[model samples]
Target chain A: MSSNFRLQITNLLIGMCRGTPGLTAELRELGYREQWITSGFPRDVAGRSHPVMVLASRETRHSLFVEVAPGPRIDSDRLLQYTGTTAVELRRGTNLSREQTETYGIAVFGLTEHRDTLRESIEESGVRAALLLCDAEGIRLDVNPFMQAALANIFRPLLPISWAGVPRWIPFDHESGPADIAAAVVPDVVARLLAGETRIDIAEVCREQVLWKLTTEAGKKRLRASVRGALAEAAGREMRKYFSVRGRFVEAATTSSDDGVPLEHRILRIVSRRQVQLLTRLGGDDRNAEDR
Target chain B: MIARSRHHLHDYLQGRMTGTSAGGTAEQPPPGDTEPIKTYLVEVRGNGVAGRDPDFSVVKTLRALVSEPYLKAGFPARVHPARERGLVTIEGRYRGGTPVSMYADCRDPRHWLIHTLAPGRTADWAIGRMAAVGTRLSRVSMPGQLLEKLAGLGLLEGLILSHDRRQFDEGGGYGAEGFMSMQLWGGQSGRILSMMSRERSLSDSVSLSRVHVRYWPDEDDRAASCLAEIDRDGRMVTRGTSYEGHLHLVKVFRRLYTRQIENLESHFRVRADGDAGKLVGRCLTIRPARPIGNSARFCDIAFSGTPPFRLWGVPAQTSGSFTRVRALDLDVGGALDCEVTPEFLRVFLLSGTSANSVVRFLTNLQHYFHSGVRLLDQDGQDVLEL
Candidate 1:
């Protein structure tokens, strides 16, 4: 996926998490309170600067710094500092020193390759968690996916509330509905997590609702039809407004309803009202001027 | 009968010569009508990198475009070159009627000025020809095609285009009139915003509009002004001038920008490397004025570098007595008292002023200072001296 797409998805996730009460409650239960999610912070802290996405504590006590699309090899040290932790262990590469890891009290998890390690570390640390979420299919560029079994096993216990399976590329038809989906699924995922469900599958819910499909082809026709309907409705509204104004002008020209007032005066009254409205809308300072 | 006819012919000849006819009706004189010649001035300034080559090339191209074989055959024309001054003169008449002349001056490589004089329909035809030439030259992707096009339309000229990467570079200011579109990156957005605010505070004459900004997703705080429009499309659409139009312009710009941010593009591509240091500043011509001080009115005072040295704010001093000195604060930080006398204006650059800061100060001085004022280097030469 392109960087812009990733950014949009990240923003969507943050907006969903911030807006949902149930999700916030679930996060508070997990001890991740005072959530501060941002694309990148302006200032550097602990000798580290802007991270791709960060969800930090209010007082910088604990945080989750997410790198959505990881490169070939992760910069574990930088990642750790961004999370305000002294040390972190990656499943594929070097692990943090035991003393340092114990002192920092935070474990970093890469969802793709380090899923098994992350699960073990989470159980061992029993403190706070930072996660790197990616696709399991690895169909998108710059996204690394772990094996399905590994993801299921790791997430089964944690029961994390996620915006996964919403489609990496959102169709134009679904533009108006993403926020709505986010609002709905965020609370649902939180409920599932609280219930200790084996899986919290948003994609399954989307599939059932016919909002999306596991196979891209099944959703194409519906998406196109929805987009077409929206455009037609917008165009129809514009035409109606245009014709209505034209009809009013025609009626005003033909009718002699006003009591002996000249046509010029009647026309001026209508025009003057419109002019006043325009001036008011534009914040003209001459508000006290007579309409005539 | 032959003698009578000869006498009549003689009478007719005498009538024609003396403004009278055989039947005693005075002969009507040919129409005595004179049309004024319209003059258009075009000044071209290069983007420092292209040097004078672009300006010279444009003039040469214009001459070639106008002096096509068909045009010469259709109209009485003469084309000549002054190799010494690198100028070309084209004098011609349209369909053997109205006289027209074009003088392209390429004496200064950094600056080229083209002057055209023609009467009525001929003037219109010449301008049209120049526009056609500009359109053809625009395809080459050379620096100065936009300026040339503006010149063709008889718009304002002498606009400096700078994409200079250096922090304290020269040539950064808006012209009295010109068009510029730039994609500012990283911290430059902050600088532009500050400049815009400063310009807003300083003068109401300057107008900036059609601005679009996009924040970096990874660094949301660090936004980029991605799209700026100032007649870059060569549409000749004038910017908003009336107060209502200004309000509307601002509103439209804000609404469009917000919409763009909400619906981001599918793919994000950074500006191309080759486009680095592209021309990004406005070009302005200096109007002439009488000398302020006791010095010779036309003496050349050369400063070491090019004009418009990235100065911020207008020059504070005006022509008057020195007793009532104006205390001025520099944009780069620091205050100085300025003394403006009829003979000369003296500026005191306080201690701890950096060279670059001084250059910036001088740039503004060149622009906003008295028209007669010229900055001289250590050698007593004009700053803009070749």
Candidate 2:
């Protein structure tokens, strides 16, 4: 059981990293080391060793473990194992501003207007949860207190629903709510998937936020089962154009038209070509701007 | 082209080319207070491809000058190409109803000096616009350490630092409550800095922004009293300084600025390491008072506040005591990832990220997040020697 899970995660890591050559090459030069755990790792319920990949930097002493499709029992054990020893989950914690939230809305709207890929991806995953109802309008977490708390804690910083200038987790029972209460959310998830240096995994995002806080095995199980496929499918739909999906991970598509040009150089090239064209037309033909 | 010589430059600065003044002589000193020169020194990246003669576009820069953002905030300017190559005259009227004229010398591909005879505020407005236009152009950043070194050259006149505490004061109401700006003027200014250096609490609380000083070059024929006011963003205002004196100071300032640029570039330089190329990546280590991993306050202050910095972060997979975030710099169109621990913060810059963007980030980090922040390269060397 452990080998199968480990193989699945190892394959996911290989596919994602290979797709993200720009990020991979850059990270390598910076002295960050990656270790893939294929043998003698921690075990789960069926006595299978946990499959994980760890990326760490020696200078900063920073390490992060990437796991594949973590279930509640093993997730809880891993949380207990790393409890206080420099292994903490990254928290969003009301970091998403209103303008950023609006950008997400725009991105989602553009995606929906251009193609029907998002709706199809969501339908194919068969994810039916209160969170799935989220759109450009706002988030809808119409569920019990426990489920709402689980959803809220799992996705902080991205979905910033606030009151009196402080982030608050609201349980909206009806569709028509206060403007601020119903303010946009779901699009932020799309934005997160689209705007990043490296590919992100749905299972990894879930493992990062869910395990650290949940202590009880029952709570972890319930939270894991609550909205499993919904979030993953939502990520798939939003990242359709900008990213290429490989299993559970979504990597940004590397365009070949630019022929390996770095993103910065590409932008500069466009602006520079435009500048030269404009200068020639403006009749400013004097040269000698180059050093040589 | 205007002859790239000391004599011609002297004539230009003294307004002798336009016949505005008779120019200064050794026996007769130049009119003080009446002929103060404000120079907006800009760093430019190549906008042209390989084998291009005019690597830095003048017409593109003209459009940037008359760009909507600049015109709305500052003034309406008309740009005319000079008879000399890589030179342009900008004539405009400031919003305050003052006629302003500036000479932009773009002879060098690496740097451009925009000189104006208008008020200090006029220079500020123009420089601010240039900074806001695009990533191709930027103000030469003189970090706090550079400012301190410049102060040591001669008598210190004034110092200004905007120590930001907004992250600590999260719930504090709006207005000037978020930051504390302090300015000091007098001789022996090092005394206050010495005190702060000794007191850990005071030293770590404030970040340096601007420094005003008066220094005389060692050359006997040089101007005796050269008054200079330099800020962190590389705008220098000079008064009672001759053309030679100005060039001397600029030479020194450029050397320091070049050193900083090289240091920042070294941090981002990409090189392969043996077989571990797959596992290794660059890391810029910053030691701040508080840990930034998973800190909402750090994100709000660093990414959300300014352009070229306006980015959004998504939580990266992590366990135990480490937190990683993946973010895209929307303004500069670059992507970067950050890892945080209790003692230090590590930033992993990818392609598309510029050294200038990193400088701006480090500068802002010193102001808003931690004033005593120190940058260390992957090998644990000081990138910015503060």
| Candidate number with greatest DockQ | 2
User: In model 2 chain B, which range of ten residues has the least summed lDDT?
Assistant: B271-280
Candidate 2 chain A weakest lDDT stretch, 10 residues = A103-112
Q: What is the C-alpha RMSD of each candidate to the true structure, in Å?
A: 27.0, 18.9
lDDT of 1 by residue, A1-292 (tens): 2222333344333423332211223332333321221112322333222223333333323344445323333344443443442334311122222332232222233434545554454445343344444433322111222222322233333444323222111222233332222222222222222222333333332332222321123233444343333322322332121111121121111124323222221132242233223323322221111010
TM-score of each: 0.25, 0.55
lDDT of 2 at A26: 34
Instruction: Go through the candidates in order and give the clash count of each.
Output: 17, 16
Tens-place lDDT per residue, model 2, B199-247, is 8656665778888877766656544557788778777777764544555
Q: Each candidate's iRMS in angstroms?
A: 28.7, 18.8
